[model samples]
Target: MLYIFDLGNVIVDIDFNRVLGAWSDLSRVPLASLKQSFTMGEAFCQHERGELTDEAFAEALCQQMALPLSYEQFSHGWQAIFVGLRPEVIAIMHRLREQGHRVVVLSNTNRLHTTFWPEEYPEIRGAADKIYLSQDLGMRKPEARIYQHVLQAEGFSPDETRFFDDNADNIAGAERLGIPGILVKDKTTVPDYFAKRLC
Candidate 1:
């Protein structure tokens, strides 16, 4: 069987609070308000799927907050906060690769966020036989079409592949396509979950 994993908040740690802090100074809006915007609109999704360029998205956010910072500064600070990997998760990925199952990554992430991933995490880099970034694909998860894209590109029948992701909605999307998924938890527990029959 093959294993497919989602990147953000699954293989990597995402602290939106840091992002909020960086943009707050430029937006002149309270971090809380910015978070509300994130929750209430398509700002984040649009940015992730590459519908909005970084400059445009940052400007829109600045306009929403009525802040004084330049889009470049806001975007730079927003991108700089993430650091390191969950070592245990990395180890699990390596273990899976050693077992000879094909491993792949499908993430709904923009170019800015992905620019450093290949360098920051080389082991996971080696683990994946193929990497599909949403910005590059022009598709995002929790959406059926993106999942179908991976299925088609990788040539894996849904039944032969298992997906691991942190979001329930994305997991459900995989389920809808007849590709089973496991909601990621502590890395230590994932192997037991996988051993029980994946897809």
Candidate 2:
């Protein structure tokens, strides 16, 4: 069976609210207002798709709040969004690969985050047999076309592919395509999940 993993949240932990809270102090804007604009402006999506540079995105965000912020402060807040990978999750990936499974990463990430990916997970550069970055693919999760792209590129049948993602919508999309997918809740239970399915 082929295994596909989602990067953010599933592999790495992220807290947008934490960054937003910090930004709130700098922007003097209500948290609710900032969040509403962020979602409405699709700033997150733009950032993820590489449509907006980090400085440009931050400038937009600050302008939306009518607040002034230097790019450095914005970057500091943005960088605080991601937490590290859980060792158990990393171990699970390694174990699956050691067993000869075709393990790969299918992540939706912006250039800003990816610039620091190697430093964050140095072992991952050559570890995963294959990787699909959404920015480069011009596609993101919950999109059927991206799933098709992944399956086609890997030359794997949908039924034979097992995808693990943290987003329910993405998992649902994969399921609709005949790919078995599980929402990764706890990293420790992954071994059991894989064993039951692959055995």
Candidate 3:
């Protein structure tokens, strides 16, 4: 089986509240106001799709939040979204690779978040045979074309691949292309999934 894993909330734990808190501290914006105003809108989508530059996205996001923050401050708070690494899934992916399955990552993320984590969590860089990011691909999750692009680029058969993501929409997107997707709910989801089936 060829396994395609998602980065956020699956291999790495993330919390948007961290961003709000960090920004609140930096910009003197109330947590409630930040939470209420922050949006995953077109700017965010464009960032993930690699259509918008990091500075542009950050500026747009700041505008949306009505935040007064310098680039350094915004970046600091933006990066705070990452909580920690989840290597439990990585270990399983390595084991699966040993058994002749291909492992790769397909994440809808941008350079803002991507630049920070890989250095901190080396395993994240090595967990998969290939890591596909939307920022580079100009394609994000829940898009049929992105899935098609990865499968075609990797030369993997859709029927033979399994996609694991925390988002149901992304899973559904993969499913539409005949790829069986697993909805990863928590830390144990992937480990538990292969626990009995790892023969």
Candidate 4:
């Protein structure tokens, strides 16, 4: 069987609030304004979809938020969104690997995250047999094409694959293609679900 995991909140801890707070402190921009212009705007979607270059995304964010920080400082705050890896999740991946299951990562993340996450959390770098990022593919979760692309690229049958994601929409997307999926409600839910299924 093939096991596909979502990076954010599934294997690693991600808190957007952390990035927002850091950016607010560094740029002295109002949190509400930052949320409105950056977090809640189309720029973020475009950035995640690889429509914007790293420099271009940072420039757009700074312009929208009136940030005073240089690009380097802004990048740091942006990368601060990642907290840490869930060790239990890594252990689960290792266990799955030992049992001869193929494990991989499918995440809707951008260049800034793709650059720093592996460095910050080496487990993520080594855990997956392959890592697919939406920014690289120009598609994100909840998109049928992205799911199709991954399944085709990996040559995995949908019926034999199991996917886990924290987002309901992403899970639904996988299910639409006949991949059985588990919605990870919290840190323990995934481990619990897998424990039951794998045992």
Count of backbone collisions in candidate 2: 0
TM-score of each: 0.85, 0.86, 0.97, 0.91
Candidate no. 1 TM-score: 0.85
lDDT of 1 by residue, 41-62 (tens): 5877888889888888777766
lDDT of 4 at 169: 92
lDDT of 4 at 113: 78
Q: How many pairs collide in each candidate, listed in order?
A: 1, 0, 0, 0
Q: List the residue pairs that clash in candidate 4.
A: none
Across 1-199, the per-residue lDDT of candidate 2 in tens digits comes to 6889888777777778887877778767787886776653577677766677878887877787665678877777777778777665677778778888888999978777776766878766555788898778877777899999989888899988999888888899899999999897765556667566543
For each candidate, the alpha-carbon lDDT, in order, equals 0.77, 0.78, 0.91, 0.87
Q: Please tell me which predicted candidate would have the highest TM-score against the true structure.
A: 3
Model 4 Cα lDDT, one tens digit per residue, 32-66: 88787665467777888999988888888788778
TM-score of 2: 0.86
- Model 4, position 104, has a per-residue lDDT of 92
Candidate 1 residue 108 C-alpha distance from true site, Å: 0.4
